[model samples]
Target: MGVQGLASFLDKHQNIYREVRFGRSRLLVDGCNLNYLLYFSSGLDQNHGGEYAAYVTLVESFIAALRSCDITPYVVLDGGSDVTDKKLETAAKRREDRIRKAHEAAASGRTMCILPRMAELVFIQTLARLQVPVAQCFAEADQEIAALASEWRCPVLSNDSDFFVFDLPGGFLPISHFHWREVRQSGSRSSVSCRRYYTSSFCSFFGLRRQLLPAFAALAGNDYVKLRGIDWTRFVQAGTGTEACGRLEGLLCWLKGLQESRGPLEVLEEALGLLGDLSGDKRELLQNLRLGMEEYQLGRSALSRFFLHGAPPEFPALEQEAGLVPGWMLLPVTQARLSGNVLDVLRLLRMNLGFGIETQELPSANQTSRPLRQVMYGLLLGKDRSSPVVEFDRAGLGPISVPVEPTFTRTSQRLRLDSLPQVALSDRLNVLLEALGVTQESLRLLPPQLQLPAAVSCYWLQTAQPPPDLQRALLLGMSNTPRSTAAFQNKSGIQKVDVDVSHAFSQWQACLKDAAQLNQLLGLPLPEPDVSRLYQGTLVHQLVHRMRSGGKLKTVLRSDRPSEELYRSLLSVVRRIRTRRTRQTRQKAATRRQQNPPEPSADLQRLFLQDEETESEARAAVAMQEELRLQEELLQVRTRYRTKERSNRSKNPDLARKEECRGRDLL
Candidate 1:
């Protein structure tokens, strides 16, 4: 997709990328890239609102995270997939494959990574609801982002390799590496922590001038132009760190050598002429170079401003609205007044998104469903504003003032969220695991039915493939494979797609064997994991003994003392198990008390009343909880009196409360 071998080439030959901080700067986001990011990250069935909510949350958090890092975000979405004919054909083929997968997923009733037809609209609507700045490009988002970044002097945030073709001065920061770390030895021989992949920096590192970038790309070939004719094996030989002046001529010499009769000059000219006219990888450098020029010429960045911020076309000729007015606006989540930590921000977002608010907003369950869009629209409208001052002096009217006018502000332009930090994509799923009170060790033992759902629900940008759930499920062992699945009908019957995980199981078993090789190498008396030394706590015991002896523990214990060591280790294990059970018993008692407060029997109560400290804490908790109960009763009385006062006010228009009532008491 990028210069064919650019990524690998840079990694092997030199350190091309450097980590740089861009605090308080604006990032131009590629919305199409983020849409796929969210789709793949979600695990809920498409039928569930939670799936949609996850998509919305990802976009919200992505912006929030950047803002938290002091970088403002401007989202730009693609208008259509129109592209060069060759690229369009490739995109069409991929789209067909995606369509087939979507059909299969629909039958199975699970989430798939296909971007829905409504995705672009849904994205725009979500951003509208969130009050974030967003733009829909007339063509590709890449062109818009590249052009905007260059003109605005900001970094384009994306993983798409083609941005390099824009030759922008402001540079590009790969979204995949927003918070990358680096390791390097210092002059004191210690690594100290310190960027973007600037086009200028990249060319500098490659020992090529900026102007030669097109030439370099042509030789490499790309999505639009492909290498053709020869294998290109041994081309641009590795470690050939020759000077810049020698590089091009060296390439010419290599090409001329390939053809005994042809002169170097003719070889170069012929290859350059026919490069982009065809498709396919070949050994000829000039063929690749020719295609590169064609691709470069097609770069669309020059027209970016027209799509992002050009003057509106004459209304009579305007067929559609093309751009969003640029600026940030506070979302309803901000009204929740959250401090923006991961959990708090997530809670606020869900509340505003209609997941949490509905239960609380309506007084009773018998009430009809409230359309979320209506509430969202009201929240998005924001507070009313007084009209701007008349300022007749500017028109030379001499102190003229107009009647008062009231207007409502629709959008807010804020650069930052609260001081609280946002969670990274890598750590976001860990929050869910923490809430569930599960650790990495329990992953392999999770039940089968819950495995896939849990795995999918937690899938994020950094989720590993062949998801751990599949591995965990395979570990629990398999059942008799279903020979045929029941057929189902929607408009037509759909066949079930059966998965064969036997190979995966075999692969896991092989992995287990490799791990067990340690035990086998030791030649212990115990088979597999049964050896006494395997779990022996002698190492720690010896260290403790040594400390007490003012020397060590290992010395007092003879090397042959396996029985004593085994006994100590087994005893330690027993203690750990008992402690785990005791903690679980206390947790259960606490949960029961929360569900239904009851005095426990002597034996049951003693389980949690383990020590003086615990008993004191329990007493404190009981005493403090009653304070809220009393406050609630007081609130009920206040509400009763207030309603009575309102009723009196409505009846006579003479009640003391009439002047102060915020809402009319007509009812």
Candidate 2:
């Protein structure tokens, strides 16, 4: 998503980045990047689910390290993808690549660098616990991060190459070089050692105007605009980091040649001229080129007021800004209280990337949670809307867009998206409970945090393909069940990620995430679980293995009475919900059969001639199975929707294939 080969090119020049003993100032951190760096850098489990507690400890240590050096950190996170569809092509390619890598990682036993589902939630919660100032922006936080850093006269800490192009007064510090864990003390002062890059140094090295960075970035091909068919390698000077850095070096050299004589606008025009004849597409290309460059233009940070006054940043204006997002949701969306999937639903585009350890052959784990997301979609877009949400989900080794109609229950139909906040708490709770098919009374016996998870598990059991066995349900309940802090202090040794087990847990987590979002949208009718307490990869997988080896729950829990009680209480609630659902399904089936009875066939007459009680029991069982199958089909989104090709149809498939080949050759 940055200028191609820029990070490596800069890394080769030691003079461009000066070593600094960093401390005693405000540092703006890219929170999403930090989350990825922290989790993957620590080599925690990525296969099963996540080792969130250990990840929390790592975050706490990081914050403590910053405080020790008197360094103040203000973290910002990205909310959702850009609604303009500017980066849709890049996103689709990345999604396809991720799904392929995930399958490979699942088959082979390598770490795939996939951050678990709840890692973000755990990170945000940990920051709150440590009293670190943090904000999640409505969209990409790159510009906001750069803006805040410039205003504060402090370095932006991140590994993103886009930061290299942003004109920051303070500087840019790549997280790869920032040694927060290695704080050094020299008598009176404590400081962390790191490398810092000032835009001044970069501009000086390249002999170009600092303002030309945006133009330079666009010409080199970023996520926003990839100028096809123009090869700049022929224009580069021989042996000036050209072979190693690819086309970026060539582009920089060309920019340097025109720096003195031409302005940014002229350079853009001349660069577009290199593409030769575009016929009718020239204007569109020029507009896209300008749009790409506009990304690096900076202004006063909108987040300044957010950090200073506890106010959410105002929604930034978009190209398509009419009713794309409801005004009421802007605040919660900015606060990071609501999930980004909300925006995805509203925009009719759901970008779902596959997990690293999921079994590709199995039905996507996301399918199990379709019902939950459907309710959420209904709440966002009115109940009566017929438009389907186009979901870019991983299928086979590629990404496919499935058009899924949002399920609007009688409960969901009662409330409208705009007036949801004005609704009574009881009515909201009823909507949430009915959607999950549970009662408040049923959830009362479990811990507050476990209630939503328990309900999700019940829903999963009822709808999951090849319905989960009792043991699987019990393990899921245990995973959601909270344990003592001491129990999580030591991590179990790394073990191979079983694709089936990993996929199962992935589905459970998906359901929990959607349910949590639904609750948040419904004014938090149910208590939101502490994400860290919900699941731990190593512990849960180990427990499953122990149970499979004929170990009892008490033995696996080390005879911890309170933990066992919590596990049993959660399991009981889930079982009760499942039982009630089955009863309702059977009753509905009986009513339907009575309303439209089939003529008695020979087989039915033969069955009726046998024992009356046995025939009735067999007939009831068959009807229940048929009814359940039909109900599951109704709940599952994929079954109801038709899949479409990748949305970026403008790019020829053959040309894209050639580009992939060319990319490898350039590398």
Q: Which runs in model 1 stand beyond 4 Å of their true positions?
A: 8-14, 41-50, 81-86, 100-112, 116-119, 180-194, 238-667
Candidate 2 at 341: error in angstroms?
Answer: 2.8
Candidate 2 lDDT at 634 equals 30
| lDDT (10s digit) by residue, model 2, range 89-167 | 8988888777877777777867778778778889987886677888888778899999888888888999999999998
Off by over 4 Å in 2: 238-245, 317-320, 347-356, 384-386, 470-495, 598-667
Q: What is the lDDT of candidate 1?
A: 0.38
Cα RMSD to the true fold for all candidates: 25.7, 12.3
Candidate 2 local Cα displacement, residue 643, angstroms = 52
For each candidate, what TM-score against the reference? Answer: 0.39, 0.86
Q: Tens-digit lDDT track for model 1 on 540-641? A: 222323343465223233333433232232222222333343467678987987887766685577676579757765764564455334444434444554
Ten contiguous residues minimizing lDDT sum, candidate 1: 480-489
Per candidate, the number of residue pairs that clash is 18, 0
CA lDDT, candidate 2, residue 267: 88
